[model samples]
Every structure is written in structure tokens, then in C-alpha cells.
Target chain A: MTAALIWIFLPFTAAIGLWAWSRHPAQSTRLATLLCLFLATTAWLIPIGKVLRLGPLTLEIQPILLLAGRRLNLTDTDRPLLIFFFTIAAFWFAGAQQAGSHRLFIPYGLAIVSFLVAAMAVEPLLYSALMIEIAVLLSVPLLFPPGERSVGPGLLRYLIFQTLAMPFILLAGWALDGVQANPTDTNLIALASLFLSLGFAFWLAIFPFYTWVPLLAGETHPYAVGFLYLLLSTTSLLLGVEFINAYGWLRNAPQLYLFLRWMGAIMVITAGIWSAFQHNVGRLFGYALIIETGFSLLAISLNSRLGVEIFTMLFLPRVIGFGLWALSSSILLQAGRSMEFQQLERVAEKWPFASTGLIVACLSLAGLPLLAHFPVRLVLLEQVARQSPLLAVWVLGGNIGFLMSTFRLLAVVTGGYFGPRQPGERPLQITLLSIGALSLVIIGLLPRLFLPMFTGLLSAFTRLP
Target chain B: MTLANLLLLPLLLVTISTLIILISQNWRYSVLALALQYVGVFWLINGLWPLGLAVVKLVAGWMACAVLSASQPAADVREEQTSPTAPAFRLLAAALALALVVSVEPSVEARIPVNRFILMGGLLLISVGWLHLGITTRPIRVIIGLLTVLSGFEILYAAVETSILIAGLQAAVTLGLALVGAYLIAAPTMEETP
Candidate 1:
């Protein structure tokens, strides 16, 4: 319990310290990075299984706090969830170190981690909206580092949409509370469901609400963009899961399930189509994430234990793969003069390892066979097909769109024929690329290795149903 | 009412004050508005004494306001030379404020504690201010607007009584973020017209 608390709080504490230290020009970036690593590792190493006990009482650390007349019990399932969160935090720290992100990265990364943990731990759902808003606000410094040119409109658009989503979520949580008090209140349940779906729709940046993703991609530093997308996408997916887990009524609602499925399918198809035409690599990544989110929604829409299992399994590989992709793209953009495809046409010749990493990562994202995404996609498709073939077709169409986009990206990277490599690239780039490529290959080759672990995690949640 | 409701009062006040700052046309009044707003918030939190840390935040905010006011150059002298629509704008703002207050009343149940009412009113005000600030082109107004929003959120933090430690931390963060905003305003972006 102490460890968990420290894990969550240390980042926030360090952020303030680093922000103060940042004013000093002589400050060592290495010291900040080492400190972040230590804190992140400590968080990752804490054992999550045992419930803390004191005398006759037991306590569980969770994202939600339920205050029922002095009886404070966290939800039972949040233990494993915390473990997952800490693990991701560790990976983010590693990525930050490898990328040599700006000086603000250390503090900003810590702040984001703290915010995400708080978002996960907050109770009653309404607080999640507020927490997410705080996360967005914190993200601005990361997105538009000091000395960068005019701030991207994407940040503003992101703020507006996210803020717009908050009221709906808060209102829904309040309405859900009313329904929970009176279990058979269909009217309250209906209102809660509508508000929640609408809120999530906005939060996920699905379909019509997705302009910010691409716009943000256009303006953001690749590494910052990567972190933002990962945090938002994964957290939103978890929130969707938590929403279902918390409200049994909504989970059982057939109409709600149908709505999620249809929306997911629509989002997948449209985002995929849009992605096929994107020339900018960052926007391409954004569209791909939008499609991936659609897949997650499809999994939830299935309303089955296996569906949830597939979703859980999908997270790790996607995070690793997407992080690699984002980091590589960031390096490419920094080294290359422009983000346009025409400029990137000879990227393979210029940066061979990075080009390979980008290609592999894109392939993994497209769920090509043998990549980490393959097995998850297969399971997701099977589940969808079993329920409805039309839905399956929609998902496949999205997959095809992802495939087309990847090919476009690949074509640009390879420049039609691989040429001689450029010299004087940093050794760090080589190391980052090799690790990313090796991990993708290993995970793709042995999907079963991680699949069972995720399946086990999913079972814990499914048992409640 | 519950202690939860009582704690929420400060949060509401801060929010309302922020909104007032955002929409207030005269830059000079915005700082005064924010100061008065923070005072109300501090008083409300001080009354509850939910967490020992609230005192620190209240003090920090007071100090920040003082420093900011001292450091800032007088409101653009050019504004006085260029415009005479201040009264009409103030009148329009007052009308909007009235509508906002009226609109929020239906949402607030009578059972809610009086302190919570004040807090809620403040939050609404701050949110309005933030919206006003975000839309406006004037750099000073934007900073004031953002600060008002932060203060409103800080007030909301008071109501979250269970996690006193987290609330205090959140308040500190709000102050830091506000300072950053102020810094941005003070050092105008290259894109902004001089």
C-alpha cells in the first residue's frame, strides 16, 4: 500500500522539484532521467496481489473511492489494474530516456503519470472527467514546449472537446448514482446510458469528434504526440471498461451494446478511409489510433468474456509497437526537414534502422499476420463474425484501410528502391530501432506467451458478471 | 448537509470568480476580481479546515496575485485611447451573469448546503471566465481568464474533502500552471501582434 501511494505521489512531487530545477541552466538532464527511472522502477516492482490488512479491516487501493458512511472499500479488481498502470509508467519512462525528450519531459512525464493514476483511482466516475481535464492541461507544456512557434490549434480543439465531454460524464455519473440508489429506475438508467455514450464518444474522438487527433499530430513533437495518444487511448479504453464494470445495468443493456458496436464499426471504416489518403506520417498514426480505438469498442460491444480478454491482450503490444512507431517518426521528423511524404521518400536510404522500425511498427499496427496485432485481430474478428457477419465486414474494411495506409507509409519509407545509408547518425538511434524491431518480432512470433497472462487478467473482471 | 457539501463550497466560489475574470473587459478589474475571488475561496476553506495544507495554497495564491500585480505594467494605455464601449460590455456581462446564476439555480437542489451554493456559484463564474478568456484575443485578458479558471478549480478542490492531501497538491499545481500562463502572456508569442 505504501509503495503504491509512493508510486503515484512521487511523480507529482518530482514534477514540482524538476520544474523548479529547470530554471537553472546548469541542471543535469541525466540526474532528472535517473530520478525518473528510480521512481518508475519502484512503482513497477511493487507487488500488487496482497490486500493491505490492519487488524480486522482490509484495504484495497483503487481508482475509485466509495464513501458509504465511513465504510471505505475500494473496488476489488483495481489491484491488477494498478499493476498494469505502473508497468505502462515504467515503459513510458524508458521511452522518455531513450528519446532524449526535451528538459520539460521529465517533469511533464511525471505529472502525466500521476494524473493518469489519479484518473484511474478516482471514484464515482465524475472525477474521471476532471482528472482527464487536468491531464489535458498538463499535456500542453509537453505538446508545445517553450520556444516552440505558435501553439497548435489542435491543443485548443482538444481542450474544448474534452471539456465539452466532461459535463456529460459528470451528469451521467450523477444520474447513475440516482439509478444505483433505485435499481429499477429505467428512466435514470436510460439517461445515464445516453449521457455516458455521448461523453465517451467525444472522449474517444470517434468519427465526427476526431479532428483534434490529426490536427494534434500535425503540430506536436512525435514523442509528445505518442505519449498523449497512448495515455488518452489506453485510459479511455480502461474507462470504458470501468464504466461497464461499475454499472451492471448498462453492461446488460442490449441497446447500449448495439450502439457501441455500430459506432465502433462506423468509426473504424471512416477513420480507415481517411487514413488511406493521409500524406503526413503523424496524421496517419492518428488515424490508425482512431481505428484501433474502434477495434477496442468492437471488443466491448461483444459483451462477452472473450471479448474483454482480447481487448486486454491487445494493449501491451499496441503500446510497445505504437511507442516505437511514434519515437521513430519523431526521430525521422527531427532529422528530416519536412513531414511531407515526398521528403520522406528516401528515408530508408538515410536512416535504415529507423526506417525498418517504422515499417515493422506500422505493419504491427495494421495487424498483419505474424505481428503482435495479428492474434488479437483474429480473435476480435472471430468474435464479431460470430455475432454478426455485417459487423465483421465493417471491421475487415477498417483493417484493409489500415493495411492500405501502412503500404503508403512503407512505400514512402523505402523510396521505391533502398539506397545507401547516410553516415554520422547517433548510436542511440540504432539501439532504439534494434530494440523496437526485435521486440515486435519476438512478440509476433510468440503471441501465446503473453496471451494467457492477459486472458487471466480478463477473467478477474469477467468473474463479476 | 454532509461535510462533502460543505467542502464543495470553496470550489464553487473559485469557479465563479474565474468566470467573472474571463468576461470582465477591463484588464485592470480582472486582477481585482481574481483577488476578491481567492479571498472568498480561502475564507471558505479556512472555515472548513478540512486539510492543514489549504492555508499554504491560500497564502501562495495571495502572494502570486500581489507579485503579478506589482510586476505587470499598467493595463494597455492604448485601450483607453481606442475604446469607449466598456460600459456597454459591463452591462452585457452583468446580464449574462444574471442568466448564468438563474440557470444554475434549477440544477442546485434546495437540500444543498449554503456553503456549497456559494462554491458552486463561484465555479460557474470561473468556468464562464475561462471561456471568455480562451476566446478573447487580448493576452492579458487570456491570462486573467485562465487564472480565474484555475482558482475556480482550486475552490472545487476544497469540496473534495476526503483526499485533503491530493486536493492541496492539486491547488499547488493550479498555481504553477497559472504562473506558466502568466509567463506566456508576459512574453508574448512571436505570432502575436506587438
Candidate 2:
């Protein structure tokens, strides 16, 4: 089997097999965790396109496979990215065992991950638009799984916006055809810029386009939405970088970079302000994600290697921070029927570990000191401060929205000093929560340990390197 | 009317029907209009692909409408009841949509080598589709709007590039949109929750 096909088929086939095996959520969960871990390990360890022998069986895994006349190419440089994708998948899949969701969470989750990987690998790469649309479609069932089904406003909005992005990207690719050779083609440049920005804006859920984020988080299961949100943003970021690398004019466009910065600041401030008033923890998590995107956009706006480094480094913290946050929310959801602030009054006493996980995850996402996200946030804000102190101050000020929620989440869980304390928390919850918390602190204190892994990421895109 | 306007019959049908679906509350009329819109799209796709491909476009669109129709409840108020101002709003949007298409179609026709009616049809569908999506909160209407928007892009793209790969991709996208609509239609209502 070719490298590309194997990566795509493993999850795609597993999704079908696991679903057919038994629509039981528990079995699907176990298989999904195992499959994700195996994929992650393979992605990390195996050399792409290397020939292998197992007695009489000889396998030469070609890096590219053609499907319907289009090439699906898997390169050596893609290994790190593939590893990142699978590892993040494994994290979510493993966490899914405790995070209450539909039976399809495991199966559909794998399929979505596979589709996203295929999107990154597909050549003529505009085809990635189709792949993303397919992934978005797969997300629909997850949003309104079997039995409990609300005609979620979030789901419809998500579908409409995501579908809208596909044509813009595809047409932009067509428009960019000869523009490189003809840089003087002002009209083409303008068209490409407009389409690409609109496409990315919808894909990344930037600003006003991001209403679906909080809405979905408020209504649907947190784990599923979190996974989809993180996957879409990461893939979109990769595509954005690819655009910069491909178009010399776009690569050099300082105006676009400034626009990204201004927009990033706005997203940060807006999401922050909204997060501050959110009474729903689920919506709070959604706003934190927007804050993360804003910071990421800010990093890109720097238009320098430092910016690229910070952005690349974000892959790690983003996965861990969001994973922890989603996992905790899902756990708490299982503990209680609802997470409305009043509903959560002192419920943390019964689910101590979940509450603790929720607090740490929120703080981690908020870029609090001594958490997974702090190191990157610190460096990024410092860089911003160096370029424009007001921007730095603005970003810091926006984070206060998350900070305010953190305090509120803590208060809601604690229920004042007079509240009664419950007995022991669940063993499994305790273990996962402890691991998440410890990892966040370790990564926070030792960002260097993980930062090096991402340093090699841009090298994969040699155009930028 | 000029030859372009003569050729614009199918497009005009598509634009008028798209507006009907957007403003009308009856699920039955909306489905009929949606199917007709797809038929209009199929006709416009001519000269770009084989007769077989155009048939595929028509069939896929019809199937999407069928899926959505099957999922709807009998005697459903899938969208809000029409207000007097709604039609006025739609009329204003129709005018704006017309302006949007007129302003861009010429530049598009000049820059890209495409049939004039095809260009205008695609732009008109896209403009009206966006307006439809923007104004509605109902899931079914939203789905129809999405289908319309995609139809415009697909029609334009088929003209620009007609590979089997592109055709297959677009077909899958249609199916995906249909499935989402079906899912949303069958989902338990929000009012069911306390």
C-alpha cells in the first residue's frame, strides 16, 4: 500500500468496521484509542516510502497514490505533521472513553481526522476544499447524533459557512494560475486576495463569522465540537502558510500582514469580552478557542520567522490545552445533567477531579503562568509588545475575559467556604485529571522540551524556509 | 431581448424560483422550486460537460431535494410564516442581487472565457443564495440556500474546468449537503428541552 492510502484507509476503514462491529459506544471507544495510538506511533516511527520485508511479504510504500487522476502525495517532511495530527487524534480518542458522546464519536472522529489528513496531503491542493467540505458533512451527524436531536442553529450555521468557503478557495486557485508570472496583473491579485481572505475567514471562523463556534459549544457535546474546531483551525493555518509560501507577492504583502494583526487583535478583544459574560462553561470554552485563534493570527501577522516559530510551536500547546479543556467539560457533563452556572452550584464537590481539570484547562487556555499555554503566550505577547506596545496591552487586556471566566468557574465550583465537601472522586477521573494537570505544568515550565519538535515544521515547507 | 437574454431563460427561472423558496413558508413549494432550480442549473451546465455529466448534476440535485423532502414532517412549518414585510425584504434583496450580478458578470465574462448566460446565471445564483442564507434562521431554508450557493459555484467551475475529478467532487459535495439537511430535519426540536 502507498503511504498516502495507508494513512487515509486506516481511519476510514476503521470507522466503517468499528461502526458495523457494534454501534456500542464503549467498544468503539476502545478501538478508537488503540487505532489512534497505533497510527500515531506509525506516523512518528516509520520512514515514508521505505521498503519493508516480512518474510515473503515485501512492501514498498510509495509516497504518492493517484485517485481519479489526482495525486495524493505523502512526503518525508509531512511525517512530523502527520505525527502531530495522529497524536492529537489519539489524545482526543483516548479521552473520548470518558467524554460522553455518541457511538459515532470514535468512528466518525477517525473519519474526520483521516479526511483532514487527506486534505493536507492532496495535490493540486485546491482539492483540499472538497475534502474539508466532506469532513464538515461528516460532522453533521455528530452534532445531532441519534436519539437526542435538536435542529441546532449552530450546526446549520456551521454547514452554511463551511460550504461557502470551498468555492472561494477553488476559484482563487484558478485566478492565481498565471498571476505569478504576471505580477503586474493587479486585477488578478485583487481577486485572489479577496477570495483567499474570505475563504480563510470562513474556514478559521474569524470575528463575526465565528458565531457558530460558541453556539455549537453551547448546544452540542463539547468533545466533538472541540475536536472539529481544533482540526479545522490547524488545517486552515497550514493552508494559509502554503498560500504565503506559494505566492511571492502575497508572501511579501506587508499590508495583508497588518490586516491579520488588526483582525487578530479584534478577535481577541471581542472573544474576550464575550467570554467574560458567558454563564455557560461550554460557551466559555468556545470563546477561549477564539482567543487562541486571535493569538495565532497575531503570531502570523508578525510576518517573520519568530512569528512562524511561535505559530508552529502552537500546534503542541493547542492540542494539549484544548484537549484538556474539552475532556474536562465532557467529564463534568457526565457528572451533571447540565452545566448552566446555577445548575453547577457546588456540583464540583461531587466531581472534584473534573472541576479541577476544568479550572486548569481554562487557565491553561487563558495563558496563565505555569500552564501549557503560558510559555507561548508570553513569548508571543513579548514579540507583540516589541513591535507595538499598544497591541501587546490590548491582547493582555482581552485575556482578562478568559481570566474573569476562570475566576467565575472557580467560584461556581467551590460554592463558597461554607459548602459541604464530598468524599472521594472517581479513580479514573482522578488519574486523567492528574495527568492533564501535571502535563500542563511540566510543559509550561519546560517549553523548550516541546518547542524543538515544532522548530523543524517550517522546514517541511521549504518555500518559507 | 438579445441572445444573452434569450439564453437567460433558465437562469431567470432559477433566480425567480430561488427567491420563491427563500420567501415562501410552504415546504412543498420550496422543494418544488429547489428541484426546478437544479434543473435550471443542469441546463446551464451544457457546452461544459457531456450530456451524461449534466444528467448527473440534475440527478444529484433531485436526489438532494428528495432526501430533504423525505425528512420533513407532514404539514410542517419548516420556515417562519411569511410576514407582509418579508416579501418586501425579498424584493429588495432580489433587486440587490440583480445589481450584484450585473456589476460583476461583465468583468467575469471579459476576464474568464465563459458563456455569457452561464456567467450571469452563476453570479445571480450566488448573490441570491447569500442573501437567502443571511436572512433565514430556519434549517430547511438554510439548506436550500446552501444548495443554491453551491450550485452557482459548481456551474461556474464546470465551465472553467470539467474533469471527471471535479465532477465527482462536486457530486459528493451535493450529497453531503443533502445528508446534513436530512439530519437537521430529523433532529429533535429545541423546544423539547426545558
- iRMSD for each candidate structure, in the order shown: 7.2, 4.5
Model 1: residue B116 alpha-carbon error in angstroms: 14
Q: What does candidate 2's lDDT look like per residue over A34-132, in tens digits? A: 887887788777777887787998767688989988999888788888878887888887777777666777778888989999998898878898999
lDDT for each residue of candidate 1 in A21-93, tens digit (9 for 90 to 100): 8644225344555655665454344334457677999864443333332112223345455556556655655
Which residues of candidate 1, in runs, are more than 4 Å off? A14-79, A97-100, A122-130, A163-171, A456-465, B1-177, B183-194
Sliding window of 10 residues with minimal summed lDDT for model 2 chain B: B185-194
lDDT of each: 0.67, 0.83
Please state the error at residue B114 of candidate 2 in Å. Answer: 2.4
Best by TM-score: 2
Q: DockQ for model 2?
A: 0.49
User: TM per model?
Assistant: 0.76, 0.95
TM-score of model 2 vs. true structure? 0.95
Residue A35 displacement in candidate 1 (angstroms): 6.6
TM-score of chain A of each: 0.89, 0.96
What CAPRI-style quality would you assign to candidate 1? Answer: incorrect
